[model samples]
Target: MSIGVEEAYETAGMILFHNFDIRAVTLGVNLKDLIHPEAEKMCAAVEERLTRLGTRLVRQAQAVSGELGVPIINKRISITPAAWLIEPCPSPQAPLLLAQAINRAALAADVDFVGGFGALMHKASTQADRRLLESLPEALSRTQRLCAFANLASTSAGMNMDAVNQVARLLKEMAAASPDALACAKFVAFANAPEDNPFMAGAFHGPGEADACLNVGISGPGVVRAVVDKYPDCDLTMLSEIIRRTVFKITRAGEMVGRKLASLLGVSFGVVDISLAPTTAIGDSVGMILHGMGLERPGAPGTTAALALLIDAVKRGGAFASGNVGGLSGTFIPVSEDTAMIEAVECGALSLEKLEAMTAVCSVGLDMFAVPGDTPAHALAGIIADELAIGMVNNKTTGVRVIPAPGRQPGDCVDFGGLLGKAPVMRVSRFSGSNFVGRGGRMPAPIGALRN
Candidate 1:
């Protein structure tokens, strides 16, 4: 990965002054080879492997961050899907024990989050997959650093309404077991989920991947917003060109850092996900980028078009930067994590329905938004089904990370603090989808999937 000298100097300025940083450097370690029939030994071996790899991951990430004078905000680890490892051991306690072991390993290594603690049931759930689903509420409620995901739908296999309904009830259970429904923040439901994504709550080492590798997620909504703000009167074509140029710089920086870190750790370099993920900080917002693009606020009349243009420009820039770009390489519009999005919801400029439409174009689906506590499980399933359908039909990766805040009503706010941030409870449709969701069968894949 090579960068021009002038481009490097400009990127360094963005890092030194602007709020540009590598969001995460995730080590994907395959646990398939370590599976054991003895539950006790399996758990111990998993813990030991994670602890050893995670510690080196953190140390090397920090060293790289210091060397480059750019901050790497998080060092994370993702393992093979827990259900695959737990299948060999039929013990009922296997899921919980494995989750506990993962939590311990994350803590021991001082890593922020450990992912891939769930299963893939895009078509159907096996006995072990069902067991893992049943244990999720307890496992997520008990563990702090462990994150989980379930890919209930995909373009090829269509939607698994049964697993979708199951995840809804499990999320409700997890919310009831935790204060402020924090556990729900750690879970994601996906359609067309990526195996090598380095982002949290959705990353996993796919069965087809190598033994171990390194992937990077780079974020710079602030940097892009700053550039867009500077060219206030630029035309739409010029605006896109500006965004593409800025994102190219961001992706190049990520490529450089990811390669250096992978070399130091003696692991193959995976991909750089140049997603413009936002935070609670004021300037760091994908919504603000849209605001700069001439939208008064997100979810306004032209919000979807703005987001589509932004995502397209970002992807083009990333492709220009590196051939290895993978993952959900576009703009992420998680409501709670972006101040502009939170304000949009508070002011009624954004609605759940509008967010569903936006998901058709954005990188991920209805992420980090909260709905009413009284929202029924089938209603949650309805929401998931709608979002997943978008991904399945469009052939893109989309996910839902919604929280049902306990005892909260529409307009009520739940403060999760830190990176999870605060979210205003958004209103859901009063009409129930129980009847539709109760029709528990696979929704067939779209015609698009038949291509090739």
Candidate 2:
């Protein structure tokens, strides 16, 4: 019952395990220096900067991760929002050129995704932003490591009707270009965005951020699920207290790793995102945690309430442990990534409907999970729209990162190989959202939106 933050985590550190720590530390680098108005020079400058930055990040991260025994997962980099870089591009060709440079640079440095091929026009869209919007389909499709995004709304300005409509249109086109439309999953629309979030296909270098910053996203679902499983009959209050203590220990571990890595790299420490992130490993399922809490299954009647309690306790603990706990610091229920969740789905314990409801409390929705290949794009967008609206009205952060597994039907599994995880194609509602999704205006931001 101690209220002390550091002390509580220090005490809990004795039993920290299943939350086996690893972080995806992303470095956001501003690219204004790479823009030269002349396409040739601009392209060269970009390559130089990205190559240098990537090399530096990877080398430093190697030293740090090796020292800490916690893998740095990705030495990825996010650039200044591409909309700013292309504000004066006379041709769509320039964006393609710029994006290619970014992608190659990431590959050259052995990184997975190079983010910030995006536009931020929650309030207004300029012609350049519009052109980048136009070019995104080709940019993401053609570039191997490049990711695209657009910030369409924010709490301060309400939702942007024009941007939302445009993104919906973009989603349809992107879906046609790629069956997975995963390129669109790479494109995020944010509300009340943060300056330093180390995860992507959504992370971008916000305008208000430093020239470059390092944000860390730590993953530890198995650790937590194991802790909860040890106490099958603990009531909600005791459950919350137990979870708070465990998460605080995990957060301290993350802070230790982040600060040490940042110091070795000679960059100021940014924020530690204590997100209950999962991998494609067994024992890493949020659903499994619920099941261990004695839920006969994850998506049953009491699922939402259990999830809400889990979320509140996680935040309360994480907020106290880290002076700067940011990013999507909530539980992730991505079906395919966590082994337990996939089993829950295969066992008829979790459903698409239940997963959608879970997004109301979790960090992201349908993240990298496979859906029936036959699922209509509008229906997909409609599903995404519903989850986003939950965050919009409720004034919390929510996102959808679904992948309609190309040519994969239900009961079939699509393997993304790494952290993207393999998922059995989940069934979708056999319905159409062509009419609903077509009404692409803002769902007027809800009344009494001030919750924080």
Candidate 3:
């Protein structure tokens, strides 16, 4: 993966000028083999594995980042779904204990975050799944670095209204338990969620993966926005081509760094998620990219079309650059994380409905948005159901990470600071959807699921 002199210079320019960097280097460690009938023994095994591997991951990741001159922002670990590991434990408190153990390991290893405190019950819930799900409010509120997710729907299995209803209620409880509802940020509800995602709150090592693997999430929102700024007068077709070419170079650089890091760590190199994840840094924004493409602001009249074009070009470029592109490799529209998106919400240009419409094309549905705490659980369920239905019918991965900020009304602001950024709380509808969401049953797979 040697680079020519010109290519090296261009890569350096991207890092030095634009905000091109590897957003996350996530090591997926399977803990299924460490499962024990005794929760204490299981916790010990899991902690030992994570502490050992996580230390090495942090050490070597820094070495690679220094060597390649690429900034790796986050070093994380994702484990086998917690539900499977806790299946054999008889103790009702096992989930909280496991979360504490994982958090201890994360602190010892010095990683930014550890994912996989979650369950997969898109169609049906097991007793273990219920236990894990029930403990999320306490487990997440008590732990610092542990992220959780629940997959409640899929293209083949359809939507689980029962799970959706339960999660909605739990989200409210989680909000009430944690300050500013920050615990809700650590949890996501997914439909058709990916197994090898390197992002937080949604990353988990799937049952089918190898015992150990290293995955990367590369973000270049600034780089793409810079390229878009260069061609002000170009037509949309040519603009797409330009963005695609730029993303190809970004993906190549990510693949080089990821492969080198994996080799150094003696683990299998997994995929490079070429998602345009934005940050609070000035000029590093997916929303600004739309603005550069002639939109006055995100959520403007042509915002959805603009996002679709941006994401399509990004995926095509990533696919052309590497065969190992996986995860939610598209544009992220987190309202808090992106400066322009936050401005849009504050200015009333972006509504909750418009964001939901945008998520049909973007990755990670309804991400990092804040709402009023008094919003009913039924309304939350309605929102989750609507978002998941898009994924189920469209057969793409989608997720929701909404925060119900206690005592914060619409138009007020909540700042979690650093990476999570500041959010201007948006208004949710006062109307209720309890009658529709209360009828607990599967939504049945869409007609497209019959493809066989």
TM-score of 3: 0.98
Candidate 3, residues 1-452, lDDT tens digits: the string is: 88799988877878898889999999999999988889999999999999999999999999999998889989999999999999999998899999999999999999989999999999999999999999999999999999999999999999999999999999999999998899998999999999999999799999879989999999999999999999999998999999999999889888998899999988899999998999999999999999999999898999999999999999989999999999889788999999999999999999999999999998779999999988989999999999999999999999999998888999898899999999899999888889999998999999999999
Task: Evaluate residue 315 in candidate 2 and report its C-alpha lDDT on the 0 to 100 scale.
Answer: 85
Question: Per-prediction TM-score, please?
Answer: 0.98, 0.88, 0.98
lDDT of 2 by residue, 1-452 (tens): 85698765643443354546655878878888666677767877888887887888888888886786665666678778888887776875888888888888888887777888888775678888888887777777777788777766555455665566566566666655764555655666665445566777777787877777777887767777877987888788999998888788778777877788777767767888887877776676677788877788777788988888988888888889999798778777777677777777788778888887887777655566667666766676677667666677667776666666567787887765677676767888887867866766555656666556
User: Could you tally the backbone clashes for each prediction?
Assistant: 0, 2, 0
Give candidate 1's whole-model lDDT: 0.92
RMSD of each: 1.7, 4.0, 1.3
Model 2's alpha-carbon lDDT is 0.73
Model 2: ten consecutive residues of lowest lDDT = 10-19
lDDT, model 3, position 7: 82
lDDT of 2 at 235: 86
The better candidate by TM-score, 2 or 3, is: 3
